[model samples]
Target: MTTRPPGAAAPATAPPTSGQTPEQAALRPGLKNRHLSMIAIGGVIGAGLFVGSASGIAAAGPGILLSYALVGALVVFVMRMLGEMAAANPSSGSFSAYADRALGRWAGFSIGWLYWFFWVVVLAVEATAGAKILEGWIPAVPQWGWALIVMLVLTITNLASVGSFGEFEFWFAGIKVVAITGFIVLGGLAIFGVLPGSDHAATGFDNLTSHGGFLPNGPGAILTGILLVVFSFMGSEIVTLAAGESPNARQAVAKATRSVIWRVGVFYVGSILVVVSLLPWNDPSIAKKGSYVAALDSIGIPHAGQIMNFIVLTAVLSCLNSGLYTASRMAFSLGQRGDAPRSLVRTNSRGVPQPAILASVAFGFIAVGFNYLWPDTVFQFLLNSSGAVALFVWLVICFSQLRMRGIILRENPEKLVVRMWLFPYLTWATIGMISFVLLYMLTDDSKGGGRVQVLLSVLVAALVVAISLVRERIRRNATQDALASR
Candidate 1:
């Protein structure tokens, strides 16, 4: 594979020639630098961070900050490896394409389909979450109606053009960033006894140690906290896929990789710190009202719950918008490489992958139907089946980077604009850490059926891998037969 320098224009594909089909047309570089920047920033902030941190804080107490840090570090390392490869060769496939070249066709096919499955499930999950909020606000519409409306709006945005998706995500992510930043600032002032009308007794750093110390449930709780908060970091890798469409794919990817550390530290660890420091970790309100909302209420903020709901709603929409885009792009990439139906590679006059987007949203709509029709049995199974896919994707990146490093260096060392820290050693360490997290998930069942999620996710992954291997064997046999006929 040839490599381009950082900030260089992406490699161009041949324009449609006479009698050539539009299916052979290339994806347009419609995403701007600002779009890419916000995508990278907003990718780290998920709806889970807004709604999910409460359980983690309850489990790990103030030590939940440590849990965030551990997971943050893992993400930073994984992003670095991904950045190194993506910078060298920008593709919408992102890590999946790298896995194909570095690992094997089977590895890429398995992980690509698994990742796609994960995001389409996420589409249903986010649509439902957003619909609930909308329903509460306007009791006129049923929850399923709201779900259909939310999915339809974003699906239209994605179908319009990549730029439209970026525009929507830009504002959705912007709201989340501003809300989190404001929360941190106000919570910090209250913790220091500076915010007026704040409850001095409740808003102080003493909350961290006053009640059972930081690790209230012993050190073991930190691992449990890891299980709770780890998935909140899932969206951080979306930027790499988005970067592939930017004008300067290499620079866009490298910049996002470099800044991931601070993004995690400030948005995740820093915000959680403000939460734990503002109120006692064991405070029932924290668990009941969520970490951020409870923190705002302690500082005498009026309508704290409503305010947080709005922010969480924005986060949900952002995740939904990006989920559709990411899933479709992965499918598009897979199609380009012959893993998926060639129909998915066909782009419209505006350069949008129409078929791919429709295909992804079609399944998303089905999942939404299952969510309403069988919330307990069918939807629960779908959720569990895709639960551990985030870790699986990260593990694949680590392994792909291990082999891709040599390929990049041998071909063009200068293309290594974003290098992984410590090379093979750090890469291997990341692999071990992710594997450990997956294994740890097996023994823990107290939090949201951890073991069952892992087991079911493993079952799904094994089935995908089996299909990939079978397909590869058939393709190889066909090639041999064609050669024999020649």
Candidate 2:
């Protein structure tokens, strides 16, 4: 069952076999366009949007918009490249498979395992954050208990079926879209002095200019903002991973890629613009309370702050679910490609990869246990280890696209349903840009804490690469021995 990596032509378009299970049957050539559409919308707008932006705004002040732009543009390029390969041959592995096909087994194995590691860490982080919020509302229950409950609930939902996962994501993304759109619309009205009880004080576009004229942190700050925001958009590409299980994968990838940038731009930059405009960059609330909630309160909206908390909670759960799914599929993909244990590839009757799911969840359970036992040590370790994979993932996407574009055009030119514009020119420029960011993180004062994450993630990436090289050597020797026996 080892299919050629994407960009190779499907072998003569042979008809699919008969007597397949319902999942094997309904698993359409393209994923359900609806499922992918929501995932694309929701994935980028997850916990990062709700929680991470607070720190970015605090670091860069009113000028965080520039940070969102820089990172947003990078994501546009990454997703375009990913879309090109996913459209050619839709697979649950997404970029991991692309790396294997375009690069080599070592590349695929390293990237797949690294990505799996990324999501499992996120699962623990999100559930921990979510549990903290739950404990706020219900002091009777400890945070550990809340974390367990949240994990079990999502685990059941994910194990139900692809359709159930799709349904949950649909509503999850739906709420995010509504919240952002409302923020933009409502915040826009307030900025123009439209709200009935609007204070209309020392705000009104002055914050952008008054505080060192939007570049208060200077041009250098823009790059710092990129470091903050780069992680925010990490989950957007999960849509392609889910595409392999649905009906119209090519179409979904195409539409999702094409529309992804503009959507992210509108939501991320737009919301930041509204927030900074509504409040002073140096406002006490900016540091004590988040920029977004503080701004909403400044505009005379009584409960807007708490209302946002609920939305943030939804965003956290959405990320938790997606992280579990992403890690599971990655492990499954690694197994299928002979990189991981064979048991990980085993699918339940519902087409769920049980071993992979459990393996991914295992870390969350352990991290939760640590939270119950020694909160400080385990929490910092999780934070430190979870830091830099976003950059790594983006770098791999850029490289995979470089190799994939050439192969797709050469092997099956017609299958380029969604082509990246400017070809090798923009693609090469993107590589350089990402390289600069990684180098810059080492010295950037603005990324004081973030540097730790970047460094740790680099260590993880290196370890994965080392393991991949060793594994490949062993595999090669086994292959040679088998051939010698014949």
Candidate 3:
């Protein structure tokens, strides 16, 4: 840590709303605690966890659970830092605003834009996923039609009001929560051989070690599993970002971060455990079908796969909605801070950022056209470019909190409601650990052109730096010209 001057002004550390103007502050107290709580719950349980755990298990066997645990721990650490920052200065901009204040204009510019990129990419990906599931259910409709319907419907809901979006998400998240709870309940019963038709004798804890032993490929596989499954937790932190728009943003951040572990850890580990236990790693259906629905179907539930596809569809839509909202909000914030074009600062009567909405829609349309054309090239290009941003965002959160913490401790320690454990130590460790993870990913086989993606993301970050520098110079020249005229 760098030393600070004895009398310099430290950044204030009160909760996030401390920085928002009155107008922005009045947007909406519309999202209730229930909505936020469920958002936190549902955010952790994305389509990836339900359908993608098979890939992790295949890569690492039963040791995949350890992979999730490592990532979960890292997320918990990162969220704690984010909570500390959000508690002090919750705003619609969330970490972007924090980055601007604590780091500098360029850090905020780069990280904020990178995050917007991530969400936009996510918006298209979720829309596509939702479309595929809907097309399966209604073959008469083309997949692109399903994507359009999904986007426009959610777009209208979001445009209506914050309350409308929150309410829509509330029910969608409710369905997911109930379904996952039911899954755990049913899987538990089957595990103990209590279910009505639980015929699999290998459902007990013995399965953990029986199949070529627990670490089938050795302890190294657990690390490999982490490489595969860490991305599944990507959407979870979006809750804190979204919560900045809620009433009592600081409290929401604290509460959401406090409970993140249980949501990410239990759901991930619990679900994956039940999965490998229910069926052997080498089972064809695990690869042929998927891990989530297949696990339910194995327990004699009729149409479990279809039911799960529907649930996964809901998950995808929820993500698309949130993705659109997040990207737009970031763009709106950037415009407000002079990092983007001024037009995005406009808001409709409903306080919706209409320009931001249109921008998001424009990107979605591009994704739509790409999907219609050569999806493989476009999707791969988008995925690879945005692949490294999550780490970048996490790194920003860590640095922001590191600087924000001291100012907070000195100025108003009482307001530090949701503090990171071990503070400076854990904060530094998280930064280092994440650095190592990035390095590890560079060498992973599954990365498959990850290097190019990482390289391009770095270039994007550099571009932001260049723009910020140019903007600052222009602003200074204008100021000098005005002074000379006077």
lDDT, candidate 1, 43-152, per-residue tens: 89999999999999988999998999999999999999999998887888889988998999999999999999999999999999999999999989999999999999
TM-score of each: 0.95, 0.92, 0.92
What tens-digit string does per-residue lDDT give for candidate 2 at 172-204? 888998998988887888888886677756456
Better of 1 and 2 by TM-score: 1
On the 0 to 100 scale, the lDDT of residue 313 in model 2 is: 88
State which candidate has the highest TM-score. Answer: 1
- lDDT computed for candidate 2: 0.79
- Every candidate's lDDT: 0.89, 0.79, 0.79
Candidate 1 lDDT: 0.89
Model 3 error, position 283 (Å): 1.7
Residue 390 error, candidate 1, Å = 0.4
